[model samples]
Target chain A: MIEVKNLIKEFEGRVVLDDISANFQKGAVNMIIGKSGSGKSVFLKCLVGLIRPTSGEIRYGGRNFLAMKNREMKRLRRDMGMLFQGSALFDSKTVLENVMFPLDVFSRKNQRERRKRAEFCLERVNLLDAADLFPSEISGGMMKRVAIARAIALNPKYLFCDEPNSGLDPKTSQMIDELIQDITRDFNMTSLVVSHDMNSVMNIGDYILFLNEGIKEWEGSKEHIMDSDNDKLNDFVFASDLFKKIKEADAIITGNEANEENRKKLIQRMEEEAKDL
Target chain B: MTITGSLENIGEYALLMKRVLTPPDRMREFFREFFKEMYKLGVNSIWIVVIISFFIGAVIVMQIALNVASPLLPRFTVGAVSREIILLEFSSTIMCLILSGKVGSNVATEIGTMRITEQVDALEIMGINSANYLILPKITAFVAFMPVLVIFSMFLGLYGGYVICYLTGTPPVSTYVYGIQAFFRESFVWYSIIKSMIFGFIIASVAAYYGYSVRGGALDVGRASTDSVVINSILILMTDLVFTQLAMG
Candidate 1:
């Protein structure tokens, strides 16, 4: 479990995250969803220890992430897999080498073992054919897949992805989402993703935390989001054409029940007229 | 067991030192990035260095010829002039200028780009020392290769002078050779090598510092690259003058 407690991050006297607290459950997809500049990215950065909160504690499975020593942080980071927004693939290395890099740095495994592990991870991401290609040689979606492979090469217990579907087509975005969900389930790793894409939210967001103006306004599963009575969330949901149609359908069903008694009276009158004739 | 605040700096310093000692293999992964940088520094500036060297050699040769060819001047004056210009000033100073543009800017830009891309952060998250993985090999390679480059520059400058002298028809081959043999001292060559070594260290460190300290984005990387070369070039010229006074005194 990842728990962020009363986190406050201030930049140059301006508040980015003000007294924000949330718990991310283990072995599932936990998403931080917000509009642009709503502090989701800052929250993710804080979770990874990239940016330390001004006054807060982030506990990773009962270990204090904020107060740990450098080596301890490093040790904890070793169990973390981060997929950067740009894929951040070492542009000079091929897919195989990029995937192999973490193992080479942290593991005592020999070249052959590292290669095999890297290939396995590549296959898991369905990027085995692209093992020899460089980041530039592949498409954006492919690069993300490669990044996913590299992220899981270490068999990390925790995964962090920042905007995994940005700049990708809808189909590719769905595929990436599915991959992330499948990987989370298969590996039983705690996954925390920061994204604003609604498709991803509806598809894979097992637990969603909604932020409004640097404060977490709501937290619930995607299944209950339609029934959530929060006006701000309602405005956001109804702002879309698809959600507006769904809203119209729901209102019609509720209003039809109140008119059912009048319809029964009209039916009795019609039956009396038929008997007299 | 130390706190993150104090230990972060220590880790940064350690990574910096490690980078100065070991070049990361990821550099190969980013070879295209490196080469695009090298093309800007190495290939594009070839004409500039060549032009500067040509004029500098010609001017030095002219001044030496006028002073030494006088009937009252000693025959050894030719060798003395060649030795002084080649060993102390021309080879060391000009090469430093050339490389301040080439290697210095490269280090700054490369590391700066890495910072912008969050690649450095990625490395840190992976438990690898970003500085050691990125910086060490470059410093080692620069320190190791600079003297060789300096020697090549010295020979090229001398050849430039030969061309100038031959065109002017003022000093015969025999006179030039005799004068060079008479005045050229072994100590001068050793001093030139030592000066170049110092210059190389200064250039690499300054460039790496700017590169590593870069914040923001690609624009900042560009600024860092420019700032490093300017700062490094100034330091090189200042150190060159100081070393010359010290050596000659």
Candidate 2:
């Protein structure tokens, strides 16, 4: 589990992450969700040590990440894996080499062992045929898969993904989301994902932390998100007409009884909204 | 920027150098990377250096022969002048200027693209010191290979002079050879080699500094590459002056 206490990050006197505190449980897809410029990325960066928090304590498995010495921090980082927004694959390296990179640096395994492990990782991602292909030769979704394969090569205990669904089509995005969720469960790792995609929020957000203007707006599971009465959360989540229609449909199905004629009218309105969308 | 900003950048550059100088976590990987860099920065650069030095040497000899219309001067003066210019300035300083465009911009563009694309961050996240992994091999490769290139430049430059002189028949081949052999101070060879090595360090490190510090997007990467070339050229020339003063004075 990861615990953050009074995390604050400032840039040029502008507050990006304000005194926010939250707990992310282990073996779950813990998501940080918010609109653009809402400090979701900043908060994630702080958690992963990409950006230093102005003042806070970040405890990873009960050890203070901020107070660790450089050597100690590096040792801890060995068990951490991150998938970047752009996939961040080494352009010059083939897929097999990319996945084997961490092992090459940190593993005591022999060359054949490293190659076997990398091949196993590629197979796990269903990318064994693409082992010899360079990153530029692959599609965006494939690149994300390759990145995931590389991230898990070291069998990290903590997995962080920054906007993993960005720039992907909806279907591919769903696949990536499922892959991340499955990996989290299978590896039993503490996974933190930063995203603004509501599909991801609804699909894989086992636990979600909502931020708005650098402050925590709400925190709960996807099951409880719709029941959240917070206006800001509602505005952000229901900004799309399709979700609004879904909310209305849910109300029609579960709320107090209505006449058939009124229910038909409401259903017709929702169908129109869905058509417009 | 302000004076304070400039100082801050210098401090940051120094810190990066310190980090790059740290020992690698894996010697096997370090050697593998080092040899790869040597092939890229050194072996790949030989053809260009050879071609440029030959032409520059030919041009220097031609210009010297054309200007020396005095019958009172010996024909060997042309060879001496060509040898001196090639050894003292052209091979070391001018070749470095050329390489500042080739290798320096390349280093900047490659690293800047990696920076913008977050590959460097990926390395850092993997618990590898990005500076040591990326820049150290480059520095070692350039420093080791540059002196060899300068020596090659010196030899080809003299050969170029010989080819021009032999073809022109104004300064006879023997006279040209005599001039090369005349007043051959061993110190000049050392000076040129030292200068080229220093130039190698400047080109690699300055370009790396700009590349590693890049922020923003593709436009910022282009700007960093251009800035790296400009800054490397200026520093190379400035360092040449200091070295010349210290060695020649």
Q: Which one wins on lDDT?
A: 2
Candidate 2: CAPRI quality band: high
lDDT of 1 by residue, B121-226 (tens): 8887787767766765555556655566666666666666677667875576556656666745788777888898888777777788789989998889999899
Interface RMSD of candidate 2? 0.6
The residue-by-residue lDDT of candidate 2 on B1-249, one tens digit each, is 789988998999999999999999898889988998899888889999999999889889889989985889988999998999999999999999999999998899899999999999999999899999999999999999998899999999999989998899868889989998899999899999989999999999989999999999999999989988998888889999998899997
Q: Give the lDDT of residue A93 in candidate 2.
A: 94
The candidate scoring highest on DockQ is 2
Stretches of candidate 1 off by over 4 Å are A249-277, B1-59, B66-69, B163-169
Q: How would you encode candidate 1's per-residue C-alpha lDDT over A16-65 as one tens digit per residue?
A: 99898888888899988888899989989988988988998999999999
Mind sharing the TM-score for model 1? 0.84
For model 2 the local lDDT of residue B139 reads 92
